[model samples]
Target chain A: MTIATFPPEPKPDPGWSRYFGFCTDAKVIGIQYIVTAFFFFLIGGLLAMVIRGELITPASDLVDRAVYNGIYTMHGTIMLFLFIFPVLNGLNNLLIPTMIGAPDMAFPRLNAVAFWLVPIFGSLLIASFFVPGGPAYSGWWSYPPVSIQNPLGHFVNGQGLWITAVALSGVSSIMGALNFVTTILRMRAPGMTITRMPVFCWTALAAQSLQLIGLPALTGGAIMLLMDLSFGTSFYRPEGGGDPVLYQHFFWFYSHPAVYVIILPVFGIFSELFPVYSRKPLFGYLYVALASFIIVGLGLIVWVHHMFPSGVAQWMRNLFMVFTMLIAVPTGVKVFAWLGTIWGGKLQLTTPMLFCLGGLFNFVFAGITGIMLATVPVDIHVSNTYFVVGHFHYVIYGAAVMGIFAAIYHWFPKFIGRMPYEGLGKLHCLLTFVGANLNFLPMHPLGLMGMPRRVSSYDPEFTFWNVVASLGAFLLGVSIIPFLLNMVSAWIRGPKATHNPWRAIGLEWLLPSPPPEDNFGEEVPTVISRPYGYGTGLPLVEHQDEIERRLDLQEASAA
Target chain B: MTDTTLTPGSVEAHGQHSGHNLTGFIIFLCSESVVFLAFFSGYALLKTSALDWLPPGVEGLEWRTPLVNTVVLVSSSGTIYLAEQFKARDNMALFRGFWLLSMAMGAYFLYGQAVEWSGLQFGFTSGTFGGTFYLLTGFHGLHVATGILLMGLMLIKSFIPGNYSGGEQGVQATSLFWHFVDVIWIILFLLIYVWQ
Candidate 1:
């Protein structure tokens, strides 16, 4: 079925109608991802507000413990699976082909299949909430022993559905990753060498490589867990002689690196944005690229950081601790390089740039607190507390979520052929910034004060900050209003954007707003300039001149 | 959009880079490797915790039949390569003969696996050893069955006059899959039979 539509274009092709069922147009597929993901983002946001509301009082009065369990499960489930990750992939689907000068994904049918599976899996997980016992209550991590016990009996059906849905999504991601890796490697236009490609493309490459190597462990682990629940297998049952710790080994082997999979592309987006807005080349471009790869390498070994309290071999714990800390080394280099890029350059404080800078600030706190959690002694004290909650949300909300908003504001013109309301964007950015930190930052201290997490309510002493956090969640809800309004208003009445409104140096800008059915006219040629070749004010090669001439000729002919 | 346009496929003049096929093959192999790696990972995780050493009701295979099947599977890889050579030389008859022979060899390998499975007193759902052994070889056999079907399709398509000829997309797809099956068999033989 036709899901959504963009406004008609200057260069409409008759061929597009034939491909309607196909949805081979990358922009259409990308829009499908964005709209679907945005809906889930709203649902997930409401779940969080409910959670904050319940925590506003000392008693679990707003909802019962079971309902609170479902609310938080849906919140984490929707945000992680349905919102943040999909937004990133949606952005990549829309933009990567244009950036690399390909017409669409290397495997078009596979791309369509990947997008289609998302909603199916997403719905199955959400459907679990309405079941008899509510959704999975084992927290988002769904750790074993605690996760395995279903005193709530919510365990069997709801959690089983959750695992299956996640596995389905895992397959979708793997297919997408394979297509991205092949297209980037095999189908890049001649001379678009790996180094000469856009920084975002490089990071996408690294992210997919992580997916390639990391996801199967999770899929296998899920199957084993399923076998345990459905069959009599003891894959994770200690009573059945299955070590619950083994499940941890398999889960984090994929899940921990999945954190990088979420943030690295966000880093890639910022990498592309900083250079364009700064009117300078990204500082230490090689180092940033290397840092992405190094993070991938470090991402693999640090899965055990999640296993610190599990009583693994002591030296093994120390080894994981050291590697976990070392991961920050590359991450720190990225933060420095971003700061350096913006330092002396003519920085344009566009809405997108503000979000990028804001992400950096939030990520710094996230990373430092992460370092705190990395130490074994600190982990034992803070493990499973609100402290852990505060740490992850900082990374997920402060880092990945802001990165998504930055991309949306930055790329809206290219996607929709119009500029969103600039004033509304700034307000959204500021309010979102304040609300998120106020909501999550106090969680750290609450955790430090020995307040356990995931409970519906707490002691009267914790009530004050809980109220404050709930107020911030309301403000967080308000922030999205401007974003939605700006987008809808821009669709109706905003001025149509020029081919390169931002004058960014990338192959995507070489085409019209909401690019054509074939992507390139007559011949979709390879790009020669580096994506960051801005401020040189020289066309990297004559191909852009030819494209400009062709566009002019086509316009004149139509006239 | 530069004037330095490289031809998309320069294989005609310089024969073939083998690198393109090799790279694509490597990527496919890596993905398949991860699936098997996942299964092996399950085995490793459960090794210490397995209920018993031998699978329930399983008996030893004769070893002679497995040795024969392994040799036959390896030899089919060569015969498939020969089929490709004949196709490149436009010898339709030779290509079809070798192609059909390779499919026959694959069938022989599958038949051998069936006999071996029958010999084992345990079935796939028996226990860890039974489950791992069946899943590993069973998955490989499925791949072999798929490969044989692909080969049969390719052989039939080759003789259909005025059908897309000589290094067409269909042929390339089939060849890629054949080589993939070959590589997986090598790994399965090592992990299941040879490694122990």
Candidate 2:
């Protein structure tokens, strides 16, 4: 992080010090987000393995019901709040400024505040495990009555801590939303119109907008629940005239919209990945961006689809069913647009591209299952079954995690100034792809076979499929070792990369690998064309020519 | 929307950072409003579900203190606007005077809330009605307190060698939040007191 490290060292470069406390650079914050979220991802993944181990048998042999409840509870909460959401946010904070060619995020200090809140509050949530109650055994949604006083983990303060942690994370997310939205709105480089901005920014803006609007409901509901739990209020206690369903409505209102909020950024990443790898401009660019907003609009109303089995009215479920089905249209447009992007160009099946293709495979399946689950009859049948588990994991774990991996692989050179070990990278992707399918694909039938979810033990009849899924999950867990070794070894001693390793047109790639601390020194960049100035007749300069030409001109400003 | 009047290859002008503060502040308020909306929504849900919205033993709230508090709060908005005007005119003495007056009014409104709470016959545990009332009003009161504290900082900063001479985004931001608080209180007043 020393500005003096101009022409920063060529090889021996594990640039890890930039992630130390209170650093306000969006790039550093981005790495912090990645590292922190990835740490949590490992923990959540381990919990899943524990779950898989228990489900391997018909008996609850791995842990007691209470402990198993604690395991899956933390699994869902940690994965959603601590890992996927923050990683996407980290990517946004890191890249959006450079992608838009801004000097920094609009609110640099606030951005740091948002990043720092995660550790404080994240630790708070994790702290629930060490307490006497042994972590919040209530499910992640924590519907009240059960989520209220003395329900499961209530006596030991873990439930209250979980609620507080979630509220804090919600606050952190909302603040990031504000920072990113403002940065995009006010910070785009000259000539980068909204339509011309990178599609990633559009998705980020769309996601941030959803976070801004949807998160408060969860935060407020949590606070209200907090009051009930701690302050002797009857907000959710039924004996005192509290209606538990109200909490459900509030929770779903935010949590459902948040499902798209989770994926939209990764969707944006795909928008970036498709063009650069395919050597083609994003097909239907405007529609791809517009579809995110359409998804946002549709995502808000379809939350009640989650409430279908929870005693919502028939009219409400039908209304949500229609809206939920409508979401498939825009989502389909995005999927086809990707297909159109990769149709006939000279394809580069690099690690990032491979992951993108694999993610799309998972996302399409997820979307199809989601639509199936939207149908009132189908949803009621599969409501709390392994099918529902399969559906969401396909979307979140399959789509979003794959996108995170792809974005990391694609941008690794840009961040670490070197290429990742390609063999190892490809191995990680292969194992992940196979492991994910083996893990989640079978759960559809298992769900259809009437295996209820969140159960520590089940009938022996369902053991085979559960064992299969567990084997796949173990494979998925194993997949991360190669990813970690590749990332670590690559950042330390991998081959050096030229600027613009992907030959992408985004403004960020124009700078050297591992862009300078201030990105553009002395002068902020001006965007002359859209980021998708890709393929035919676009001014695609060879990195060699630009490097040589710049050497002669002495215009390379910083390391 | 227009990129026509632009430079392409060199440094671009940063749109005034102050211009964006207001936009960001307004966005923050939108979220704050959502928070209230969630609470009011929950209150509505809980109220409607209960066989009696008002607990059997609880009487209606006495309206007079809240009404006076409302007037005090609404008037403080005026005082803050006047303070802004005076600042715009560079009338330092009057600017500080009105700003202080606005803070005083906010304090009075909060004091009114305390008196009204003391007069109420029920605790927050008294059932749905009592809980909702205290929660909404208490959260709103926190916002009011936060607004005043921000103003207090601004008021103190105004005495320093140089502050709010031309760019008073801080004062304006505070004023915007203050008004949001006032507006929410008005709605809260109508729902909690007037309707009752």
Candidate 3:
């Protein structure tokens, strides 16, 4: 192969101050998103501990009933909107342009605005605690009737702030979704056809598409709910001849698919990491890529499953149950594809791989419970029970959060140009896996035994499982210390990572570790083959030899 | 030598085939439409189920003013389209005239809505009918106001010579948004007035 000369690298990093300012660089904005999201994650985790403390006994001894309601409500809201969504957006900022060989996101300024909105809305959500009537006690779903009841009669009550915060989050995510979809569809390196793109991009496309189509309903609904609370519009109040069920329809229309928006990226993380750690090509790459859209199609129709127990028509319930069950087929396709990729390969058993494995295991369990909950009879039996809690926690905390940790660990080397301490990472993984199961698994039985959710006190008979879950939650809280330590210490002073540390075959790995300001500099790579060509000996980009040489030179100069 | 390297500028130029900003804006409009859909669905649901379609002791909406307003708003869509055409043909004067006319029409429609609101006996707190009616029209009225503001900005920008030299994507986006606002008004008129 002829060695081709490469262009000069772009300007060096602008140092740490760019992160604190309104920087438009996608990478900086991405790190800003991640760090800000992680801060909210710590807050959410602390609330979880408080919740566990209350649930440790069968009585509401740790906090007042209303206080407990505020804690758990904020916990769910912070974890979903403030943490998972923004961290995933951060990863999108860091990965999408580099993977596709674009210079930056389609709208870099919009991306920065999206990141800034996270902190804005996060502060709004946190500020609710100090407001009259405390935080929103109607849960994250914020279903009306209960939500519209402003007992304190303040115009700027907690529920009003909560609604405003949620509406702003909706606006931010919609903007983000537009940017991602446009970038993925329009911006790609030469010869990187839709099929040749990595599965992560495909998943991002699917997930963001859901955000575009579904989020607005929730936003519009929230605005109406806000009016009902503050302005007396009666969009949901029954005394004014409004229907409370309409709010449920509006809320679940997005909130149900909102789960998929969170998990699909985790699914993408799984697809990207499995092949790298297992030393194999992704099994059925085309199928895996196509499966994401299938999930999106199926995901939109299944929102009605969440409304099954809300006195929806019987025929509607039956139809939604089938739609909800059908989602498992596409999801199952991905799970099997991961298994097939890792089945007999030379598994690395790295920290990222371990987390992926644990995540996949948890996801399968969550999927089973999800299917069970989709059944009209089963859902009705455990509609408001702890069973519902256990099922989602397994998905959110167990699968999606674990998948996020995997991506962070997997890309840490690429993200910060340093290898995370493997010992700390493994300890974090073990504790998370054990604690997640211990925390959530017993909720299944509690739910089946008719232990209702969103309650501070429960029957004495439910105490044993609640104790186990509380202990598990405390352990889960402790699990974060090791991760934080690893990220900070490893970033500050760890072994330097070379590009392609895992020998991953993708455009991102073709660049120097931490990549340049403009990712590919002045010469963008022309993708020649599919990603995850681990054992095939196929080059990912044309001029692979020259690119490697140029990366080495760049690293040498930096050192 | 099969050379496949792409210059960084060319990489951007390659992706620029489809206008990135326009595409992003169109996607944004799709989300905006969904928000409107949510409100429409609420309105439809309440209309079907409520005991009184209109507030007690209040008559149905007067149709003549709203009908005239709808005609005015819908015609603005055509005027905005002409504005886009004139902008493309480099006729700045006609573009400015048509753009201003469209904004004037939009502002007139909002004025008509406010007048109609004042004429009504029932307020937002009257009943479900009053709530849905005000929310839907008020929301659409907000969009119309926004469209007028956007047109005003474009009109100002047009004064700076060579502003459209980089392509009239901004004008095109504003026109698209104005058209969307107009179309939503048609739907709102039919749902709240004509159908009722």
Using TM-score as the measure, the top candidate is 3
TM-score of each: 0.89, 0.95, 0.97
| CAPRI tier for the interface of model 2 | acceptable
- What is the descending TM-score order? 3, 2, 1
Query: Candidate 1 residues B87-179, lDDT tens each?
Result: 788887888888889899999999999988887777644555555676678777888898888788877777679675544556666767777
True contacts kept of each: 0.13, 0.55, 0.61
Q: Candidate 1 on A21-112: residue-level lDDT in tens?
A: 54766677787788888989999998988898888889989988878887887788788888877777788888787777666777777788
lDDT of 2 by residue, B41-79 (tens): 787777767886677777788888679889999999999
Give DockQ: model 2. 0.45
lDDT of 3 by residue, B134-153 (tens): 88988888898888898899
Residue range with the least summed lDDT across 10 consecutive positions in model 2 chain B: B1-10
Clashes of each: 1, 0, 1
**Model 2 chain A worst lDDT run, 10 consecutive residues:** A1-10
- Over A1-559, each residue of candidate 3 has an lDDT whose tens digit, in order, gives 1224353554565788888999988988889999999999999999999998988988889899989888888999999999999999999999999999887899988888988999999999999999988999889888878889988788888888999999999989998999999999988887789999999999999999999999999988888898888988887888888888999989898999999899999999999999999999999999999999999999999888888777889999999999999999999899999999999999999999999999999999999999999999999999989999999999999999999999999998997889999999999999999999999999999999999999999899999999999999999999999999999999999999988788888888987778777776446777778889899888887778777877788777868
Query: Distance from true position, residue A38, model 1, in Å?
Result: 1.0
Q: In lDDT terms, which candidate is top?
A: 3
Measured against the true two-chain complex, the DockQ scores of the candidates, in the order shown, are: 0.22, 0.45, 0.52
Better model by lDDT: candidate 1 vs candidate 2? 2
